[model samples]
Target: MFGLGPAAKSLREQEEQAITVPASKLLLRAVLNLVVAWFVFDEARGPMAWIVVQFKPSLATSVESSDTVNVVMNLLYYGPVALLIAWFFGRMGRWPLVWRRYGRPLVRRVVDAIGSRSGAGTPGKAPTGAKAQGEVVVDPWWAFRPLVGHGGLALLDQETAAGRVGDVDHQRLNRALECVRDYPDRLAALLDAVREHGAAACAHPSGTRDLPGRHSGRHDLLLRQVRLGSAEDVPKNPAAYRGVDLAIDPALLGTSLLAVGPAGTGKTRRLARPLAEALCLQALAGTAVVVVVGAADADLGPAEWYDVVVAPGDPASRYGLDLYGGARRLEEAVARLADALLPEELAPRAESARQALQQVVVPYTEAYGRPPGLRELALLLRGEPVAWDALREALRAGGGLTDHQYELAQRERMHGQVDDPGALLADRLSLLDRPALAASFNRTSERGGGERGGGRGAGRPGAELPLFAMHALDHPLRVRIAVPEHSHPEAARIIARLAVGQFLYAASTRQDRSLFAGLVVDDASAVIDVHSVRSLQRLRGAHAGAALLLRTLMDLPESLRTPLFGAVGGRMAFPGIAPWDGKLFAEAWGTVWVDERDVTRAPDTSGGIIKRSWRAVRTILAGERAQTESVTTRRVERRRWSPSDLAQVLPGGHAVLSLTAVDGTPVPPLLLDLQG
Candidate 1:
């Protein structure tokens, strides 16, 4: 029954009508009682008549006179006998009312004693009240359900009232209780404790563990509980509910973290900054190697923590990213660079450009025994004979180049076609030629004066940029590269793409899974592509992870969004999200069945009129009676948190975390307020 109208009337109104009898119903009940009384009297009258016959034998001889006398005597006996029987039956009809008024409390007290002794108390029992040892005070209604058992009520209360336990923990506790019940000694001790105090008395102390500066274990980077939301009434025990502070285990993070939030929502300050700081602490302790990529103008915490700051196009920066430093082989480096410069949709052109660039790169490396910089590569693509002597010497020493190779190089030199694929690639890469940008990549030294021919120079093998070098993952290194997208959007994207590709390649090469690595990219939507998606999918196995911050998913191509969502092991969504994004999260969290309680009330007017009426000598009494009933129903496959609720209802500084469990199941979405 559904209660869907005005508020309920008071209890006094209900009780007043119960005692006052209704004239019509009372008359009907009285008549029925009189009929039952007559039946009772008839059964007893036969025996009485026999006794009378024994005393007056002469009266028994005359049948007609005896029958007449008997009828008269039976009539005389009806009033007293019937009246007495009717009163007795009337009392039986009121037994339920009597039990409710006087018997229930006595029975309830006995049940409470049994419940307390068994480590389960009544619903009204206060948690702070003195409970018997090992007694678990819980909602009595929950205890009646076959599924809930004794401990389930306590777990449910913790989850609903205190928010101390989660669904996963609830299931675990159920299993643990089952195990404890199987062992007599342990079970006895547990019950004793529960009876002595209440269930909450056994809860762990409310405090968090101190995070060490460094940790050897890969999974030790923990998100500490900074604050709690004012709106949340749930009391939390830091020790008991460790999941409140997210633990980004290496396995979970290996796939990646996708954080989506609007600007000025503390995504950077709360999520990104804190995560970076935690990673840096691990780096300082020599546990992990971290790379953070963001705009040059953004404040990404302390600079001292970073071993190298590579700001492309920032003349003041001390380090630069070598585009070719990602791979040991020249072909691999060229392919990776081409992927960064060209979108996958331009497959034909991208492939042609990669092949054209590799032809020059491979030949040049063979000639000069070193990789060329952006400047040297540009010259070669333009058909300049800058390294002709080195080429000729290498050719002579290697017993001469094939005629085809020589002809191709000579014809390119002679023609110098501007429309060539190699030239097109060079044009796209020309951004690196800018004075400020080129200076960063031109030298291996702190300043750009180490060589005449840029960082690697001719015949001088250059050290790989830390971003790509194999050894970089082995050390506690922090590499921060700033690409100011506003001034140089293409350059920023190219650098970001290259950094991501290099990290992915390096991650795939890792032999030791214990050492963890991570890449943090702020405003990543601008740079995410097919390669980034693949990298996210593969990173987990290599003990490498990524944290990508995006303002929205609108910039992402529709085809890539699903894969991107599937690839990341965790997602955090802040308030003010678009409806579509909220829907995605809603689906990720999925649906669950929940219990819904419906209460209904109907007017009950069964009581008769009272005798105390006066004004005009007319009787007056209460007109309506209220009857209430409760019914529970199930809501199956309903979304746990609706999209509209998440998009608009969540307060500022709050976000929902949908993290993947190690078992590959999605954990239910949890509401978290980082700024709390």
Candidate 2:
């Protein structure tokens, strides 16, 4: 019999047996052929034998006599066939192998067709009327639905019952919904609730409400919200409950920020401090450079990451910024210094001072290979004989001037064109001659060198870094120019303007957009002008911005206020705002048509006999019988937020923000709470 041996003891034993006693190729082929032949013969025999059996019954009368010899032969032929069939069955049974290969694939195709028709398992495409993710779909009937019973709250419970909403507090949803339920007319409140809570909370049984946080988290930078408006407005809008979020991108800052409010209204703590802290974080990460200009008494908090503090004209200050440093050329450097020193009010003197400084700066820079310090420049501008001798000697030693040029410079010095403009220039220059101020401008050595050097060229204690050496777009630097305007108003303005000019020059020179640079003027009223406004407008492409703070727009010149208002992309008007300033914001925000209704009462005389009799019978109707009603309606245009409303209706911690949208449209004024 052809039968397999018993199973091997192990996999290794099986391998060994197969290697030692492999089956013959011809014998295995013959066995396979015999197995196939037996199967075919057995299948055909079943039908043939059935037919023979049917005929045998009919022809069986002579069966015993006829089949005696045939019976033996037939039995002999059928015996081997039956034995072969049994052997084949014992070795290998007939099974359909085709179904194993194709069954799963065929069933999958049918399932896929059914799924496509029934719209199952497709994630990318939405149903016919369904909204895409992040899109707001509002219901028209949302305003009419009650927030509690059969409205948003009920819908939330329904969704929760269906197991849709997840990981949210049901109690909080119900509370928030109930809070805003009465103000169904305020769609924004309902929408904001849905956004903060879940869609289920904003879903009414009849429809779903979708509200997006458009100005919320739409940018990388954000200002905290303390409150929305008044306590009464809380139930009317979600902005009051959750507070309104202020989103202003650092890039748009070039358009500038103007914050107007009273002194104690959280302008510094809520607005300036928070913004400065955000910039400080960026500076620590090496993405931005910040310069904060404020009064010496202003509290900017502890900024440990700040790289430099340039408090010029301060007795206790560590370093000073070179008024003429960081310019691309000596002319530009001289022009910036001249602008800072000569106030715009002294136009003629400013021109002469600019010319005189330029005349000396060209030769002095050529002679010494670096621009002169403020004191040195002042001495050259004086044009005295002794100063000329010192300058000629310095120039001769450096071999910067020819004989004719030296003689020409000497003649010009004698002619007095280089003389100081007046007492004002001299006084301004005197402030720069202070030891601390001089030492700050001296960059020749590490620490202003020694006492006789007046700390000039000697670096400060830990690491003496100059403010001009810090590039706004490339380095991580925090510069605070704290000059008390009360003690030295002129000097404070000079240093502030110098810092502003230096920042503008450095930012404009940037070729790549890798860093966000900002200049924050705590009291912008002292430094803002046409030049600064133009610089603000031009610095947008260089990734630089300015945040200007003021007590009021009245602090600015009447002519400059309009330009400043138009130039800034963001404006925040706090309470105690003046009516004139409020008007400015009102116009910027534009107007809308509001419908007004008027009702009047008059005497009525016309009536039928039955009506007169009824009126006479009822004593209560006697007064109403002579009464008539008349109604009048009209549409009137009004400012969105009138000046009176802004000055009076706005709460202490709240502000009205007139911000520019990312798409350049004006966003309707938003009432925001700084402390919320």
Candidate 3:
């Protein structure tokens, strides 16, 4: 009012405008802030977040700890006020949230605004020269038209180029290319052209036939010859070449081979090398290498049972063998196999035996007991004769006894009483006749050690099974005996028969192809019948290969004869003099045999001198014995074996295996012992 200048007038006008803000807009903003503050305060109400603060007491005040409550209450009162202010300004505007509801419309508005300023107009439309900002727009050419009509844009081309491979377009192309019917010649021509072009381009054949050194779409077959020990020391090696090594690819083979020979012939030693090689392979690849033992051979006292014999630095030992490790492995495999095969039906019987042994013999031994003889035990065990040698083996193996504990206990029992040796032995055997009692005795013997410092209660209650468990991948059964033990030799035969039979079964049962691991059964005349050898043809049909070892070719029936002779894969013959045996083997082994007349022709030839030389040679050869060979054969002329056949006669250091061979060839005795 004091000045009339233009500047004064403008200032008055600005103040009037500033005072004219509408009450409605203010109310709306206040309501919005209040609403947002309510939510924030409500979320933070339950727990007051604590903050540590140190303050100097009011200098004029004498502060008491009890006065701290008033200060804390004051701080809490300001918390809600600070929270409300922060919520109103810091985040209230965030509720506009076009992203949650009106996102598309908001985006459209912003885009349109930008387009208008840049002279580009809206998107998806043709550019309008400089006014359009050079941005090409896609026109809705089909707009204003009903659903069915064609559009001006080249849609098919765009769709095809951007579509997935082998899409509808690709399928259509394939159908056109493959369209063939109504013209045989055209199809043939097309095939011929394809063959010319595709064949020329291919690096390998697509045919199923195998072409060595070239890829023929056939899987490769590997033949692994696993040697247990150095072949150079074959004579000193027993169990050296147990068979082929476990290096055998699981993809190619399912079984291995074992060639056993007579005692002092290094049969067991020879098996060792291959067995070791197999173990190494199995360990590295997590593969399984299984070796089944013949019951007869197991019954004998193989060096494998005597850990001390195979220990390092033993003079008589051929090589330091890890007997304990080997036994453990073998036992583990057998036990696993048994778990799978021992049927529920047999469980009760086995358990009964176990309980009897535990309750009767174990407690008796714990109180007042002594080791009994095998004969008396046999009488007690249902009058069935128990193998004395087997009992000895059990003792030696520490089946239920410490290394020498059983022997010492027995000695003490027999200490002073010496009346009727036979009666005494019989009575002792009868006392142990109960299988349960024997089992218990074994347990007590193994654990008790005559109660003299030996902890009879220490060992686990279960019987130390004769056979061990197999690894997971191997067959659940390590070995199966199919003979009635009515005859000692027959029982031995049954044990030996399972070895090769198992191999053949494994290889022959392939789902698709034959496992190329060949089976070898040496000395095929001792236990097996000659006619059974021909039954091995089933194996051939199954695509598996086999080699039969024999001392005489004639030992096998004529029906089982093969033109390949022994040359099919592998063959070997020891020097022998049985004329018929020699002739038969000469044919089978692929070696030429000279008659006495032929040798006398030169210094290495003819007549009386030749005859004498031939006889001498035969003598040298006859000095050695033969063993049973396991072979696969068909069921023909199958004779039912009597119970007598189940009786087993095991040699001290060796076992004899008897089985029906594929061809009617007698099984050669298979003599095997544990290697040192």
Prediction 1 global C-alpha lDDT: 0.60
lDDT of 2 by residue, 519-604 (tens): 77788776776667777777666777778888988877787888887877778788898899888877777786655557698755
As a whole number from 0 to 100, the lDDT of residue 422 in candidate 3 is 27
TM-score per prediction, in order, is: 0.58, 0.57, 0.25
Per-prediction backbone clash count: 18, 14, 107
RMSD, one per candidate, in order: 18.6, 33.4, 42.2
TM-score of 2: 0.57
Better of 1 and 2 by lDDT: 1
What candidate 1 gets wrong by more than 4 Å, as runs, is 1-243, 344-348, 384-400, 403-420, 443-471, 596-632, 661-666
Candidate 3 lDDT over residue span 330-440, tens digit each: 232122222222222333333333332222223223222333223233232232234334444555554544544553344334324543122333342343333422332
lDDT score, residue 18, model 1? Answer: 49
Which window of ten consecutive residues has the lowest lDDT sum in model 2? 210-219
